[model samples]
Target: MKSFAFVLSILAVMGLAFWAYGENYKTQRALSEVESLQGQIGQLRETRAVLRAEWAYLNRPDRLADLVGMNFASLGLVPLAAVQFGRVEQISYPRPDALPSELQLGPITGAVTVSAPANAPVPAEDMLIP
Candidate 1:
């Protein structure tokens, strides 16, 4: 009976240790996966930054104009020379007096009448505002 009890105790302890070791292995694996994912995220961010810079370079005004000229030559959007551009002061504008001044009034209402008392002191609030 003593030998059997001792054997059972040893087996229980070993079983507990094995279970703890499995849990520790799983935890370590999860931490490693998290580190790998962090590395991948950083790489993706760097790639996105490089792509944004390349996109800006591709969208430059001169490159866009060249692409349009190649793709849409029939649009007739010719580039102007310096001599073709006109000064703003050389543009003509219609004078305001050229507009007709026709009177068109709506129905008028009677004005309200109020008489002030003689020798009344000016209100203190009105003096303060002015």
Candidate 2:
């Protein structure tokens, strides 16, 4: 009976060792994948930095002015002037009396009608109390 108990303990130890070995391999594989992903992220960041530098070089104000000068006869491009701008008072905004009764600031009383296209899907009605 003592020999049988000893053999059973040995089997349990062997099983635990096998499980530990598998877990170690799984951990190494996960670490390798993380390293690969880090390398890819570094490459993408370098590419983005290069692209931004190129964009800045291409959009220089002096280069744009030169191109505009060369193309002015065909493009009819002209510089902006202050006289072209309009004053705030020149804008025609809607009057308070012209608005619908429901749109006016008041206590909530009934359902509000929202205009939508005929083919548009209708949403479920929700009541809003002020």
Candidate 3:
């Protein structure tokens, strides 16, 4: 009986050893994958920095002015003038009376109720204009 118990314990130990071996490989695979992802992240950060530098170089004001001057005749491009701009009051805003009945908000509840069909297009009269 004692010999049988010793053999059983040895088998249990072997089984546990096999499980630990598999777990060790799994941990190693996970660590390798993490390293690969870190490498990709480093590459992307480097690429982004290079792109930002290139963007800054391309957007230099002097370079843009030179380009504009070179293409002025063909592009018909002209410099902006203060007189070309319009005053805020020059904008023609929609009147409140122009809104449809369905778009009007309730006086007491202040909730909007649309009488139109569910799939019907809603008017933009109630929307705030920038």
Candidate 4:
């Protein structure tokens, strides 16, 4: 009976060792994947920085102006002047309309209530702004 118990304990230890070894390998693989992903992220960030620099260089106003001037005959390009800009007051704005009020949860009222001004326009199923 003692011999049987010893054999059982040995088998248990072996099983534990096998499980631990498998888990260790899995952990190592996951760590390696994480490292690889981190490296890719770093490379992507570097690439993004390089692309941003290139974009900035390519979009320089002087460079763009030169290109436009070279192609002006075909492009019908016009030079911008201060007079081309408009004042904010020139913009036509939409009239103020009643927007849906926020819902309040309290012990006094369990139901939801939408409050709007009496002069508010009838709520449309679909609001279109054009």
Question: On residues 41-87, what C-alpha lDDT tens digit does candidate 4 reach at each position?
Answer: 99999999999999999999999999999999999887799999999
Candidate 4 segments exceeding 4 Å error: 88-130
Put down candidate 3 lDDT per residue, 18-114, tens digits, no spaces.
9999999999999999999999999999999999999999999889888889999899777678999999999998776687876655444333544
Residue-level lDDT of model 1, residues 1-130, one tens digit each, is: 9999999999999999999999999999999999999999999999999999999999998998897788675776656579898999989876655645543323345432344568876564333320
| TM-score: model 4 vs. ground truth | 0.66
TM-score of each: 0.47, 0.61, 0.64, 0.66
Off by over 4 Å in 2: 81-83, 91-130
Indicate which candidate wins on lDDT. Answer: 2
N/CA/C clash count, model 1: 0
Using lDDT as the measure, name the better of candidate 1 and candidate 4: 4
RMSD of 2: 8.3
Question: What are the lDDT figures for the candidates, one per model?
Answer: 0.78, 0.85, 0.84, 0.80
lDDT value for model 2: 0.85
Please report the candidate that would top TM-score against the real structure: 4
Question: Model 1: clashing residue pairs?
Answer: none
Question: What TM-score number comes out for model 2?
Answer: 0.61
